[model samples]
Target: MEKLFKQVAIVVDQDDALVKNLENLVSLTREWQSSFHLIYVVERPAFSFKNIWKGYANGRTQPFDTAEHRLKEYQEKLKKLLPEGTRIHCYCKEGKPLWLIRNYIHENQIDLLLLLQSGSRFKRQPIRFSQLVGKINCPMIMVPLHKKDYDFKNIVLPISHELPLKKIMIASFLAGKKNDARIHLLALQEQDAKRQRTENPYLFKTYQLIRDNTTLTVECHPVDGDNLAAPTLEYARKVNADLILVKPGSETSPPGIFHRLLSKFNFSSSGIPVMTI
Candidate 1:
């Protein structure tokens, strides 16, 4: 089947590892037959010493010579890595990384945004990217630069009763385009298996939907866990999943035990990448 996303925008940074990771992601997208765009947001220095003294200074403001130079070097590297005749574009913006990326997605009509799992500058506080989850309309894929494994053969798609199944299905289809990839539609049943077998009709409905639409191998499993993250992570490990697709729920709500558990399961720490839909 043809790729669902015609255009994929990758947000680049100064980190070499991140650039390499983005290149791999773009390669996968191209294998699925999608166009790629590379963007590097050149942030203007906060305040130059010369600009601080001058009143209403324009020329005194710092020039993006450093940023432009770095961007050019990365562009060359990316061009060499990508296949010949691949369409690639770069943009340099002076603003916050998250906002610039979000705006780029909107203005360019991008179908998907590929970003390094954690920003180059903010590694300790990686959850900051989670803020953009609700803000952006298009789905974002976070790739861990430190990991060498790229094969996404086994995938876990966590399903809850909250979000629309259509959205999850669409995202899953885009990520797992190949027929051989295994997708597990996991649902954590707070109750026992016997009770859940009789109670939850949505589980069966989701299973039928996947079976009817896609050729990929699909399985449904009911887990026993009071906290959603525990069962999800356990199953992911058991299946040796390469990716975990989850829907970001309300952040303002109090952090339940499940939410806390998820916070601990850092994408950087886990060899598998987590894609929050």
Candidate 2:
């Protein structure tokens, strides 16, 4: 049988959250028994005197050596966690963070991309999920820094009348791989009563498709709420789900006071690990 994620790539940056990210990755590698590529990009400073002055005045050392040092440290850390004979490659490069990371993933034919979903304090611009989700070639996992000891046992998959084939397929594939794992399908309801009537038939159709195709256990529950994140999360907590399969439309809520009140319910800030293709 072929591996689900043959060539996994993880984005490394300067943040305290990186430790949690690495821990989660280690957990995944342990379960899958797969190798991964660790990439750290030293972003170039803007061509401004103020930027130059800040670097000099702050006595900030050159980024190449620093990046290498961090990479080595992380390499040692990962080795301690991963099983013996597991291959690990580390790359340190200088370029724009977004462009370089995306190009590298494409050039290397990465199967999965792991990104930490928190902002960095020192960097001018961190790698934002909204910017790279559409640009990347492979599926991306936005790992929440707070969520540690990640497992693929219970996966939350949000469903709509339109039916996301990719998300459903991926959920099924993952559930099939894990022992005693189950997929929870959260059927999203529309506000309009006319549209809501059509949703149930599609939900049943989706339920039937998964039940017929695979032997894995699956459940479909109707979720009611204006915001997708709230009800989905409520269900996840009830089921003790660890992973969420989300599309860009329902997951990527715009940043504002409303979003802030919900603790910024976007790709990275969902307080749960979210995957988008």
Provide C-alpha RMSD values for all models, in order: 5.5, 3.7
Best by lDDT: 2
lDDT of 1 by residue, 160-255 (tens): 665347555654565566667777877656545565433245666777777787777778887654435656766787888877776665311116
Tens digits of per-residue lDDT, candidate 2, 1-277, equal 3577878888876665676467666765565666789888876667799986786455332468987998888888888888888888998898777888888888888888887766443443346666676688888887766666565778988775566677777777666556587888877565555554334456777778878977778888876665566677667767777788876555444236677344334445556677876
For candidate 2, which ten residues in a row score worst on lDDT? Answer: 260-269
Point out the worst 10-residue segment of candidate 1 by lDDT: 54-63
Q: How much RMSD separates candidate 2 from the native structure?
A: 3.7
List TM-score per model, in order.
0.77, 0.80
